[model samples]
Target chain A: MSVSIDARGPRWSAAITAVVLATALVTSNLWVIAFQAVVFAIGAIRGPQFTPYALIFKKLIKPRLKSEPILEDVRPPQFSQAVGLVFALVAVIASITGAGGVFTIAVGFALAAAFLNAAFNFCLGCQMYLLILRVRTAK
Target chain B: MPDVHYAHIDAESHLELVRKLDIRSTPTTLFLNSAGVEVGRAMGTPKRAQVQAAIAAIH
Candidate 1:
């Protein structure tokens, strides 16, 4: 089933993600990364609407909005959260294993994706979803 | 120097091609032999020396 939501919600969530991830990177804090992982896990499994950042956007930011946002399908953002979860999981594992290089790389990728969405409204994971769809249909 | 051919695919425009190639990230460089079989691949930004080494190995 498709669920429609304000497109700006995910973007707002992405802005928070970018900030959280950047802070994690700067501080080299595994706990912060772990926290972000939980957020991603909730978004991926339950839906983006259930994410903490999304809730913040809905409760604190939505009411102050000046205009209505374009509605979009929730599936893509959910998929994007799943992608973030994978990266977060990898970062967590690397941190636990003491693989500093792997942890940094995983977090770096996740940060880049989040920054792209927050700054440019470009959802890399959503693009990947569309590409996968095209590939499946082409076969 | 061996003869080498170069081709570029804009991943943003060619979604199907990008999917077909299983490219997960950008700035990915794939080296293929004359028979069109993939010989080597470099993901992310690679140094020029590294790229030359990869090409030489594939050659």
Candidate 2:
């Protein structure tokens, strides 16, 4: 049986959210960014259907799209979100400890990944997820 | 518009195909033609025009 993925919504909303999350790092907003990371984690584990971005898309963007969305793997994107969650945790830790170096690296890396996905249509987290899978299978 | 054939794989569930295709990330796209040959791809999330061009190339 095929997994019934909701392919109707705007995929870019996640990227935009990431962009905003990236801003948290710039403005040095820890709790706000931490909250964002948790939200993304919830969205990943629970499903994008529960995401505010998805809701926005469903309400605003999805209606305007002229073509049906191309269905793709649900797991990778979720996994990517999970990866995002981990980075968010790192960001939180870095923030709380006043580890500006780590905070920059962690949040910066996440922001870059998100921005790349949004702007260039490339997902660094997805690659990392696949690599993890390969390692798991190999062992 | 709705005549295209597409399938979304759960990368976690289907590790084999992912490895076979060397798929590294989400929003990765594959454009297959009538004979089941990949014509184009826009990894992450492709623009509408890009996908349309891929479709057109196959036809």
Best by TM-score: 2
Model 2 spans > 4 angstroms off: A1-10, B1-59
lDDT of each: 0.83, 0.73
- For model 2, name the residue pairs that clash: A73-B9, B27-B44
> Which digits, one per residue and each the tens of the lDDT, describe model 1 over residues B1-59?
54788886656467677777887655468988778899888764456787799778776
Worst 10 contiguous positions by lDDT, candidate 1 chain A: A130-139
All models, DockQ values? 0.05, 0.40
CAPRI tier for the interface of model 1:
incorrect
Q: Residue B33 in candidate 2 has what lDDT? A: 84
Fnat across every predicted model, in order? 0.09, 0.64
lDDT of 1 by residue, A20-93 (tens): 98888887788999999999999999999889999999999999999767666676788999999999999999
List model 2 lDDT by residue over B1-59, tens digit each: 67698886666667787778877666578999878888777876688799889888887
Q: How well is candidate 2 docked (DockQ)?
A: 0.40
Highest DockQ against the true fold, candidate: 2
The list of candidate 1 runs beyond 4 A from truth reads B1-59
lDDT of 2 by residue, A32-134 (tens): 7877787787768887566777778777877788877666555656777787788888989989999989888888777888787777656666567777886
